[model samples]
Target: MLVSHQQNSILKHESLLVKFLTKYLSRVDSDIYFAKSSRCVTHSFTKTATVLSMANDGTLDALPVVGLAHNDDKKIPRKRVYAWAFWDWATQPFNTVLITFVWVPSFLTSTFFLDPDVVGTAGEEVALGQLAANLGAGITIAGLLIAFLAPVLGQQADRTQRQKLQLMIFTGLLVLTQLGLSFVQPGQEWFWVGVGLIAIGSVFNEIAGVNYNALLVSVSNSKTVGKVSGLGWGFGYLGGIIALATVVGLILSGVLQGDSALTFQLVALGCTIWTVFFVIPIFVSVPEPKTRQVGEKLGLWGSYVELGRSVKRLYKEARPTFWFLLASAVYRDGLSAVFVFGAVIAGIVFGFGFTDLVIFGIALNVVAGISTIIAGRLDDRFGPKNVILVAVFGLVACTTAVFVLVDLGTPMFWAVGLILAAFVGPAQAASRSFLARVTPAGREGEVFGLYATTGRAAGWMASLLWAVFIQLAGNQAIYGLLGIALVLLVGGVMLLFVKAPARSPR
Candidate 1:
């Protein structure tokens, strides 16, 4: 009688297992069918899918699952993805040429912007130091502006379904700012104007980015978000490479003749034209969300209240994403500092010249672009959290090495700096993918807006710390490298504690 009873219990358990497997397999089949139909509207699948069973420990309940929100959404079209990625390419010159390598460092911080009496004098370095301080101050103010406005504007975009329109509007303003840069001729009188335009440009670019980043969901699903994010960043780096090479060729070919500053002015004009041409596709291709996420018709002040509520809810519900945003905000400012001050470091500390800076920019972009594309695949395989951790570790190590090995001269910088640049793209791309993986459905703009806000809220840290460290070291710029490294270290440590987002079945 006991043996018979045990046999019956075994049979009952087997029957339940069979039922569960059947239900899970049925869901898989449905997903496959949906994928196939999606490909008909998009493009052929370029990779195979991998299916993993749910974890036994219920971590899925702790972190938002990858496809939870996207399961019901229509598959995004391929053209829209390409169009959206092109926006990064379009804006590359703003970040790459104007902000980082060529324009600001080469022109605004040059002796032409200083008092004639100070140039080539004992006080020249001091004057340049003051200019650097001013630059940092301006950028800090811009960061604060972005922190205040980005989330509120992002909420409005989500509520009104006007992301594309806002993107276009800000993008146009960004272009105008770049064009205005062309008029900032060489003179102490023109110095403040250049600083103001660059600061304003930073504001426009970041606000526009809030909209662009939100559109990641519109262009990709959970399975492809990692690769798609990497692809966009890769395109930006590649575009920057091409743009840098063009500037070098023009300079070498002696095509941009006239005042030394004319070259930068023409470069600004070229970047403006590049932006106008490339930005058109996104405006034309990516459609607005079919419906608005009008949770409530909140006023501008009410929007802040709603944003607060949203933050509290995120902390309670999507804890992993909330923590990720907080951690990334700190590290990303360090990432920005890497590019924002790279040219200055090379020029002032390592004593790189015009050709050297341009060549370094080209090589850095090349390394960054290729690594980011490859890291996308790694992100999908090992998870974005792992990819980010690895990249941040590399950044902290390289940045510290640069500061310690300062006396090793230009070759050391050439070697270590490029490696540092290599990590940047992967970190940036993974952060974007990480957020896209976990953002709740239909709230892409709001979530990504908060992403921007959180980032900007801490954005002043790098610039402020860099400036402070330099001042403390008696205006020695090399010490600023340590400031950046410290931020990255803190951020990386914080990231270690944040829970990883649930993985995609694919």
Candidate 2:
């Protein structure tokens, strides 16, 4: 009877070992396997039908999971990084070709021409006031709507698994709106159409950008994020240069007459194509980030609630980022105003024609791109803050020169304008990298949303102020631009007081 009990005990112990092996193998399979095992049965089992068993197990778990990995430093290749950067390249054609180079300038000189009586009354004081007013109104309306909606869209994107889908939708909207601009003609009606398209496209572009920026964290490691961001901006400038060259070539060769509306239409079409093709890399290389809250959803109203909650959370935890946003918004708007007004100032003050303007555009693009590349390296080494401060100071000096020294036939206008363009690239790129340094993981979308909001919020202020300065100071648009310089200088000084975040490389 005692012998029979020992045999049963041994059978039970063997069965337990099989079950343990089966379960372990099922859970880990080829990714992990048992390296070794040992089992012991006490000699007392035979003497008294009392059994004691011990098992030692070892496992190899150094295998990759299907969609997950253990390494903390995984990154997409540099080729993919370049491809991702091209998205910026692709969209910039719209800014260069349609908005700045072809449309606004053409409209002001042609279809929106002031009456001789009004022109005489104003006495070369046109200042593009009507155009500026229309632009300001559109931007203000868009800015207000975006301010209410941007954070909500950002929150929804963060909480959902459909971020890539959201990006695609907004990208589509941007492309469609840009393409729609091709239908605009040289008439009063077309003026409103162009403005509407620009406003809507701007909104969609901002929304798409929020999702697109969020995708960067998944593609790059922390160490290389600044480089990738700078590359993207540099590529954008390159794309603008190419598009500007194409349009300029067409116009100068008389392939598309400057007076023909088709010239502007073709430029708009070019922008649409550029936006569509350049974003291809993003679709191919960047994977959608997985979300923990899959299948849980938020309605449009829920998105707003989430935004409110995010703001409160930001208030509690992101005070420094908020301060940075306030300063950045004012300064960035100043930067944009300089660009927006530079061309008009060149045309009115220096008498730059289409060819001259195109050449200047190319020069700015090349200089800005080079400056951005250099600034990125500097940012990685000496830090973005220092780069930004130096660039801001440069801008201040150059703008002031444009205000105080640039006159008709004055060499200073061209010299100062080119210098301003050179600084624009580095300053904008460094600001982005600076924000990247301060932002925590998983919050890029929210912070960049604030970036966009602040940029748009008071963006009209600079233009309005410029118009006011032009009207009141008469023939002193330079003084208005100089005033913009002062705002930038003040922002830069304020920036000096803020402490760099602890996580920043510097």
lDDT of 2 at 333: 78
Candidate 1 Cα errors over 4 Å, as ranges: 1-62, 65-75, 117-120, 290-292, 404-408, 464-479
Candidate lDDT values, in order:
0.78, 0.64
Best by lDDT: 1
lDDT of 2 at 193: 72
Error of 1 at 170 (Å): 0.8
Model 2 lDDT on a 0 to 1 scale: 0.64
TM-score of each: 0.84, 0.78
Clash pairs for candidate 2: none
Residue 45 shift from truth in candidate 1, angstroms: 31
Tens-digit lDDT track for model 2 on 1-506?
01223345433543563354345335423222211112221111121112211212212111101111111224355456556666777778767776677766675334444444454565435545676678768866877877767766766665565567778889899999988988876655566677888888878877887777766655444344455566677778876876677667767877777777776677677678667766887788776754234224578887667666766655555555667777788778778888878877877777888778778889888888767865766665666667788888899888877776765454777777777887888888878766755554444555667677777776766776777777788766556786677678877887776544322222
